[model samples]
Target: MPRPEALVRRAAAAALEETGARGAITVLLADDAAVKRLNGRHRAKAKPTNVLSFPAEAPGYLGDVAVALGVVRREARGAGRRTADHLAHLVAHGALHLAGYDHLAAGEARRMERAEARIMRRLGRPNPWRGAT
Candidate 1:
């Protein structure tokens, strides 16, 4: 398997290709409460999820990708996958969204899922949406 950090960064890069982002992205691993605060403050979701992205105003910088450690562990357990793999995928997905990959529609959803699958395959992780277990 790939090293955890490398996999996460690579996934982020893979996601950025479609996001049109031109700047360095900072990836931070935070706890659930921290993620919840960010989610509530930024997204008004009130609950902590797996990952969140912050878009920077500066040119050539995509801002930051934050993954909640607690949620990641919980998600990994639910998916029966390694925590690193799950974290890496969420990190990439968050970065992609920050870069502007939206899955609010069917076509866009398929494209995003395809991008995620390709990146995860390249990183030696299973496609989370495959439903094949």
Candidate 2:
């Protein structure tokens, strides 16, 4: 398998292509503590999440995405998914968010899910929404 950074970049690139988002994005693979700190500082959440997206305003830059290794591994184990696959899914999900996708409403969620599924398919990953690993 590819290194974590390589996998993340590949997934993010695929998501950007799928969303037609232009500009550059930075993907960070971090530990739980670092992610938790970011989550608290930015979102007022005290816990670590699998992934977080930070959109940027500067030209030619979409945003930054941070993924928590611990959270992703736990989630993958619990969901019976490969850690790499889950990581890819979360990375794509974050990239989509950077591209203005959200799941705050049913319609928005469906659209995002479809886009994510398509991106995953293009990456040769399974449909994460259906729990297909």
Candidate 3:
């Protein structure tokens, strides 16, 4: 199996292809405290989220994506998926955000979901959104 960074890079390449993003993107697998601080500072959520996206202000360039590793592990266990699979999905979701897709609107949500499903299918994994039951 590949290292975490390798997995992330492969996932990033897949995400870029899936989203048609034209530039580089960063991925950070962070610990709980680190992600919690980011969650609080960036989103004002006061708690860590599984993933966060900081899109670039530039054209054709997406910015950094951070995933809370502990949160992802817990979520993956709860969802009955491997940790790597969950991590890949979160990265894909962040990449979609970088591609300027939003879930705040119904049409946008559907579009994003389709993009996510396509990416997940390519990854040979089940759709995380579909497992919402």
Q: What does each candidate score in C-alpha RMSD?
A: 2.6, 1.8, 1.8
Each prediction's TM-score versus the true structure: 0.87, 0.95, 0.91
Q: Rate the local accuracy (lDDT) of all candidates.
A: 0.82, 0.93, 0.85
Cα RMSD for predicted model 2: 1.8
**Best prediction by TM-score:** 2
lDDT of 3 at 79: 83
RMSD (Cα, Å) of candidate 1? 2.6
Between candidates 1 and 2, the one scoring higher on lDDT is: 2
TM-score of candidate 1 on Cα atoms, chains taken together: 0.87
Cα lDDT tens digits for candidate 2, 56-96: 99999999999999999999999989999899999999999
Residue-by-residue lDDT tens digits, candidate 1, 1-133: 3446777778888777645566789998888999999999999999998888788888878788888888989888987898887887898888888878879999998898888888788777888788843
Candidate scoring better on lDDT of 1 and 3 = 3
For all candidates, the clash counts are 2, 0, 0
Poorest 10 consecutive residues by lDDT, candidate 3: 1-10
Judge candidate 3 against the unseen true structure and give its global Cα lDDT, from 0 to 1: 0.85
